[model samples]
Target: MSKTILITGVGKRVGFYLAQHLSKSGYQVIGTYRTPRPELQQLEALEVQLLQCDFYDIQQTEQLIAKIKANNSSLRGIIHNASDWLPDSDSACSISTIEKMIRIHASTPYALNLALAPLLQNNPLQFSDIIHITDYVVDKGSKKHAAYAASKAALQNLTLSFAAKYAPKIKVNSIAPAMLMFNPDDDDNYKTKALNKALIKQEGGEAEALRAVNYLLDSGYTTGQTLKIDGGRHLV
Candidate 1:
C-alpha cells in the first residue's frame, strides 16, 4: 500500500484524532484545517503534513488542489471529513446559509474528488479509497438543521456517482454516524438525551469512526455503499 492519506478539517474532534492516529501508525498523513489551533501542534509533532484552506472559498479550494498535486505524486486515500453544521434557525443564518453548507459538505468534496482522482489511480493495493463522513440526519432530515441535513444528503448521493465513476481503481463510500461524540460544552442533561436516542446508549467515541474507516480501507469489494456507525439509531 502507498500509506499516504489526505484528510480535511483536521483542526479538532474526529478529524484531528484520525490524522494523529494514522500518522502514529506510520502513514504519511496530509491534513487541512480552516483555522490555526494549538492542538494541531500535536499532529505536527507526529510529522503530519498540514495545510490551511477554507472550503467555503472556491479560490482557496482550488489552491489546495494545486498544492496537493504539486507535492504528492500519489495518494492512497482521501477522507472527506471537512464539514460545517449551520442550522437555519441560528441568528447568523440567512439565505446563503444553505449555500455555505453545500459548499463545505458537498461542493468542496465534489471538487477535490474530481481533481484528485487521477492521483489515486494505480495504487499498489490495486485500489485507493474515498470516504465521505456524512451524518445520520441525511436520511430523516432535520427541522432546525434543514440546510445542514440537505447538504449532507447531497454528499451521500455523491458517493454513488463517484463510486461508479471511479470503479475498480478507487473505491468511493460514505460513513454515516450518529451521536458518536459530544461537544465539550454539552451539559449532563443534553448528553443524556442524545445518548438515549441510540440503542447503544453510550458515546461511541472517535475510535468507533476509526474502526469504520479502517474497515473500508481493508475491504476489497465494498463500494457505492454506506457503512452506518450509528449504534442502531434507526431501530430505536
Candidate 2:
C-alpha cells in the first residue's frame, strides 16, 4: 500500500507544489484548504484528495482530524504549511496581530498535535512523521514582520517539544526557508539584495523546498531539528 501524507494549506503556492511533488513521487496525499482554488482543483483532478478545513477554526480543525482517523488508521506524515501572514503595516504590528498570528502559526499546530497525538501513537503502521514549515526570518527576525517571526519561532519550539515527547515513534522536524519563491516582476536590485543576504548567494526555489522535505523523510536518524533551506541565509 502507498503511504499517505496530509498537507495543510495545499491550495496554492508552496503547499500546492509539495502536494504535487509528493503525489507524483507515489504517496497518497490529503490536502486541506480554506477556499477552493483552481490550482487545487487541478491537483484533485490529478488524484490528490481534497479536504476543506480551516485551521484557524479549532472545532473544524478537530473535526477534520477525526474524519481522517475514521478513514485511515495510519498516516505517513503531516506537513503544517498553512500560515496567516498579517500585512506589513503599523496597525498590523500591534498585539492583536500578534494574537492572530500566534493562533494560526503556533496555537493551531499545538492543538493539532494534541488532538492527533493519540491517533499517531496508535498508528498500527508505526512510522509517521510531522514536518512544520517555518520561515527563515524566524532565525534573524524581520523588522516589519515581528509577529510573523515570533509565531514561526514558537512553531520551531513546538517541533522540538513534540519530538522530545513522542520520540522513536513520530519524528518531528521543521524546514526554515528563505525566499523559496520570488516575484517575477521584482527588479534586479531587489533580487540582488535578497541574494546578497545568503551565503550561497542565490535565491531558493520550489525544488529546493521539496528536496528539504525528502531529506527529512529519508533520514531515519533525524528528529527535533530544523533544516535551513535558505541558501545559507542564516549565516548573514
Candidate 3:
C-alpha cells in the first residue's frame, strides 16, 4: 500500500515545492494550506489531499488533528513545513505579532506531534518521521527579526525535546535552510547580500531543502538532528 505523508503550508514556495517533489517520488501527500493558492489546485490535480489550516488560531491545531484522525489514514511522516516570516521592524515585533509567530512555529507543531503520536506509531513501515521546518538564524539570534527568530528557536528546541520523548519509535528532526529562494520583492542588492553570507555563495534552492526531507523519510537510524540546507551560511 502507498503511504501518506502530511505536509503543511503547501500552497506555495518551499511547501509547494516539497509537496510536488514528494508526490512525484510516490509518497501520498496530504497537504495543508492556509489560504487559496494556485498551487493548491495543482496539488489536488496531482492527487494530494488538501487540508485548510489557519495556524494563527491555536484552536485550529486540534481541529486539524481531529480531522486527520477522522480520516482514519495512517501517516508515514509529518512535515511541519508551514511557517510565517516577518522581518523584525517597527512594522513587526509587537507582542501580539510575536505571539502569533510562536504559535505557528512552535506551539502548533508541538501540539500536532503529541496529538498524532498514535497514528505515527501505527506505521507498519520502519520508522515514521516528523520534520520541523526551522530557520537557520535560530542559533545565531536576530536583532531585527526578533519575532521570527525567537519563535523558530523555540521550535528548534522542540525538535530535540520531541526526539527524546518519542525516541526509538517515531523520529523527530528539523531542516533549517538559508536563502533557499529569494523573497518576491527583494532587490538585487538585497539578494546579493543574502547570497554573500553563504560560503557556497549561492541560494540553496528548493531542491536542497526537499532533499533533506527525502533523507529523513528514508533513514531509519537518524533522529533529533536538524540538517542545515543553508549552503554553508551556518558557518558565518
Best of the candidates, lDDT: 1
TM-score ranking from best to worst? 1, 3, 2
TM-score of 2: 0.91
The residue-by-residue lDDT of candidate 1 on 1-236, one tens digit each, is: 38889999999999999999988888899999999999999999999999999998899999999999998878999999998888696565566999999999999999999999888984576889999999999989999889999999999999999999999889999999999888989999999889889899998889999999999998999999999999889998
Model 1 — which ten-residue stretch has the worst lDDT? 86-95
Better of 2 and 3 by lDDT: 3
The numbered model that scores best in TM-score is 1
Q: Give a tens-digit lDDT track for model 2, residues 140-196.
A: 888878888999999999999999998898899999988877776999989888888
Stretches off by above 4 angstroms in model 3 are: 89-93
Give the TM-scores of the predictions, in the order they appear.
0.97, 0.91, 0.95
Error of 3 at 120 (Å): 0.3
Q: Where does candidate 2 stray beyond 4 Å? A: 88-93, 124-126
- Clashes in candidate 3: how many? 0
Model 3: weakest 10-residue lDDT segment is 85-94
lDDT of 3 by residue, 109-197 (tens): 88899888888888888788999999888988888888999999999999999999998889999998888888789999998898889
Per-residue lDDT, model 3, residue 230, is 80
- Answer with 1 or 2, whichever has the higher lDDT: 1
Candidate 1 off by > 4 Å? 90-93
CA lDDT of each candidate?
0.92, 0.85, 0.87
